[model samples]
Target: MPDQPFSLDQLRIVLIGTSHPGNIGAVARAMKNMGLADLALVAPRCEVQTSESISRASGADALLVGSSLHESLDDAVADATLVVGASARSRTLPWPMISPRQLGAALPAELSRPEARVALVFGREDAGLTNAELQRCHRHVHIPTNTEFSSLNLAAAVQVLSYECRLAWLDAGDTAPARQTAMAKGTAPAGEAPFGEAPFGVEWDNPPASHADLERYFAHLERVLVAIGFHDPERPRQLMARLRRLYLRARPDSLEISILRGILTAIEKHTGRR
Candidate 1:
């Protein structure tokens, strides 16, 4: 049987701390051009519906009007099963990084799961995503550009990624069944196919944990770690960050998260903190 074509609707474009109304409009235009409709604005500095934005959006004002507003990045992507942050530079701690094309190739299999939502997050125009913000993503997507002139406009960056996603969607519609079969059988032709990659290639019995679920687990884990005197809140090392990276890379499912939480509860009971 043929696999179902990946739906653009399963993907959402999240703009964090966007300062310019015009850029927001242009982003809407770019999304519409690529057949993507979901737009999330997190702590936007400018109004979503403005004359400048409408003018820049050209004919894509519907997207701007329908866009969801979020108070924080976490709120915006709380329900997303997969979150990929767009970053131009590397951080002190390395993250699982992939190129825009690789990201495009990976989306088909990712969106195949039931109720799975993927968020493509773009940061501010001036500074880009903060270290804390990037840490929330499961993967970081970097667009390879010339070292001498690597600066990219906000809307232009969105356009580039949006184009890649549309290309992937079209390709999946045509060859998903064969490609998926080959991947399941570990016979996919190598070279830029992103086949047999961690997280993407693995089959799951339970749905991948949502961003909200992971956040709650992290909070619970932190409390338990503190209760057990295993982690210090002040004058401490990067213990939490490292653990976060570990679990994010693992991409634990809902059932796994539940089990982990249960363990934390048992630890609290044993520690006499409950």
Candidate 2:
């Protein structure tokens, strides 16, 4: 069988509390243009199953028809291994923020996992996501806009993010064919596709850790920090914030996470947290 790209399928475009069904349909169209299909709605303010949505969807009605709906953001992204929330404005408490391009670059490797599910979450049109909703995401993606009038429509944001993701997927598939051919010398037959070189053909032995795994790790880390008198829950400074930035920036795989947790356990043993 020919190699199929599962990473694209692993991505979910999640719309939360979308006030306009037309925007939902427009988003469906945008996702379709970029070879993305999975769509999830979280507590949509308007009835998504309406004629207005169907009209706006153009030929991407299948996405709208098959899209799943949930009561809350948690439920919408319950099965997602990586969740990235899209926001236009800065928040009071800074989350691990990245540009859409950065997110696009990272997703190809992340979705290489066997059962990885990535959710690109977008919030309501009026106010965007609440502080509580934004906290649920592992990373925050900011779409850079004009400083003076930065009001971006919901569907337009989806289109921009979707385009970036498509480009990233293409980059992941791109190989250095000329370099491989030069190295092959006389061994390679005429017209034969050059073998992928270096990082291009490497397989992941340990899949990237899921969001659930990270959540558990964070909980354990918090407990350990509290036990070691490093992070006092009462008078919490930027210790946890700095740690979150460090870990999220690293984006550790499963084996790495296991090693980290093991080290934490060793610390716990010394701290008498049996």
Candidate 3:
């Protein structure tokens, strides 16, 4: 059969340190154009409810009015299962950066998970994201622009990424024709399945884990490691960072996260760290 329709509601567009109210409005308009409505603002320099924002938003003013504002990026992305930061600069330390197409392909599976939340983080127009801010993201997305002059306006970047996300959502839902064709060909026995094995099997014991859940796991893990003398918190040297990279790359679902947490708990009890 065909896949379920992608819900744009699962995706959140987050702006950090947005300087201009007009850009916020424009971003809202761009998101609405691509069937994305959820928006979150972090430490905005200007008021989102200003007349300028409403006027620039045109008919998409609802997005601006209903949008959420936060004091920090951490607060904004607290509940998100996946966080993707958009930037144009190269950092001293390499990050897992993916192109827009790769983001599109991976997002569909992520958003399909139970209670999944994804955040597309955008930074200021003039400076983009700071190194510290970029480090918080699981993946970084860069919109390839002209090398000679690759400065993209905040709204323009939002438009490009939003369009790509919409295309990916549509692609995920457009599997009916292929399924029909496969059935007609009789590729296998009559009762054979076509979609292949499901991730982590058919029965899931827990709802898909959120970003907050993973963070809690990491915090618990750090405590246990400290107690077990595995990680020295004072002079730590990228141990947690590397662990974050490994787990984030895997993008474990709810069941997998539970299993991992159970393993951690067992270790904690074994070492008398609990």
Give the number of the best model, judged by TM-score: 1
Error of 3 at 205 (Å): 7.6
What TM-score does candidate 1 reach? 0.91
RMSD of 2: 5.4
Residue-wise lDDT of candidate 1 within 62-178, one digit each (tens)?
999999999999999999999999999979999999999988988877787658899999999999999989989999999998989998999999999999998888887778677
Clashes of 1: 0
Candidate 1: segments with Cα more than 4 A from true spot: 1-4, 177-203
State the local distance difference test value for candidate 1.
0.89
lDDT tens per residue, model 2, 19-54:
998999999999999999999999898988689899
TM-score of 3: 0.83
lDDT leaderboard ranking? 1, 3, 2
- Evaluate candidate 3 by giving its C-alpha RMSD to the native, one decimal: 4.2
lDDT of 3 by residue, 25-140 (tens): 99999999999999999999888888989888888999998999899888899888889999899976678999988888776556655477889999987789997678778899
- Estimated TM-score per prediction? 0.91, 0.76, 0.83
User: Predictions ranked by TM-score, top down?
Assistant: 1, 3, 2
